[model samples]
Target: MGKKFFEESELIINADGSIFHLHIKPEQLAHKIILVGDPGRVSLVASHFNEIESEVESREFRSITGRYNNKRITVTSTGIGCDNIDIVMNEIDALANIDFNSRQEKENFTELEIVRIGTCGGLQPHTPIGTYICSEKSIGFDGLLNFYAGRNAVCDLKLERALLNHLGWSGNMCAPAPYAINSDKELADRISGNDMIKGITVACGGFFGPQGRQLRLPLADPNQNEKIESFRYDGMCITNFEMESSALAGLARLMGHKATTVCMVIANRYAKEANTGYKNKIDDLITKVLDRI
Candidate 1:
């Protein structure tokens, strides 16, 4: 029997033969990719490149392929949230592993090395503003991975159940069941350091109610943050909150790629501290990732 092919509707290639959402041709993709939440950050990362080979921009997705320290790298913006991550990770893997013309999976695919450098809110006192937290594991409140098959193969069931029990999770709560996935150990080791605090990061679905922020609308569980912050598993405590790391790590694991996240702390939820002037810190983080990645 012939190999099963991806349907046109499912694996979309633009008329110009580029990935649908990312708008990047397969050839334009590099083996190494750095993911950032802001589209403007694309240029920031590319600035460090010795020379750029290509640049593509469409909607919130901006991509630039260039050389850093003589090594080829592609930096792409994912905008924000796990929803955007779903589009970015799939299209990225398709670019590396799927044959656009044949619409078939490549027999031997290139495994991508992906690192996400972003800004996040610190959940713990130790993870203060200006701290760099390497995500050893990401807890997903986004409920994204539950939709995908074989998620259990990549997720940490023990961590999931532990969190569920700690929070007394129930289907009636109208919240997604939390899931956990670890970063690529080798990649994490390369990008992390003594200066960076390594811990579990919670990736929330929204910036408001989902993250325990109050405006006019009240939170379903006002104490959700307290419960999350106090929960402990395998000697690791929740350290930070971000929007993208969970989906980035979970999807990459399923796609056989190496992925991890290192975020600079811009706000401390516990301490009620925030640093609006975090661009310089982000630049320092970019330098660290560019050098180590």
Candidate 2:
């Protein structure tokens, strides 16, 4: 037979009694999820967990579930960009919902709170290398959700329009696409820390030429990151740069799940900021965030 509808194949066992994808079932999750873009970082984050539970890996997807602050949670590696985010989010959605009979019409889903903890580049000089940015909103530069039905549903539409108007960003071939911010204010507020600097973050499409690195390739849009920082929606600011937060936030809101991303300032591109104790900052930031979350 072909692929079965409502099959939790990559979440629950299909062939035999086994956890699929990350090789974990719904019961393995802790309702609170912490995501990292690197598979190795999954274990790094889980090290802070109270109960050192099972560590499982499938492809770039590594998972460690345990307790922190007496709160149950799971840390999973989402690999690289929006494509990986798409996979991890969908699989996680499947894990949370129980559709054992393969039903299609019901739209069964269990709400889960997800937070992405990753490293990103600082767009503005104020966003120090040691700081963490909680996205108040994300600008979808990746077009990952360009095909989704409600593209701007998770974003600040007034902010988006204001940004476009302020930066005159509406006419470029790669126009600024809208992104979703976290819907739960309490969740966002509860997650912020000294290192957790919360603001708007732009989810770039690529790492090299797209993010404004010459890297031996022809230029499509040179000086784009600067242009990105030049963007503003009234007083609302775009804080940092990364690859996935926009789509993650957007899709999560579309599906009625709460999501946000907290990124470390590893590189400060403007003012030639590369390594001002960036590593030490990342190490401390990870420890602090994981301990609290």
- Please write out the lDDT profile of model 2 over residues 192-247, one tens digit for every residue: 75546777887877887767778778776575667777765556567888898887
lDDT of each: 0.94, 0.72
TM-score of 1: 0.98
CA lDDT, candidate 1, residue 68? 99
Error of 2 at 53 (Å): 3.1
Tens-place lDDT digits, model 1, residues 103-191? 99888979999999999999998998999999999999999999999999989999998898888785556667888999999999989
TM-score of 2: 0.85
Query: What are the C-alpha RMSDs, in order, of all predicted structures?
Result: 1.0, 3.7
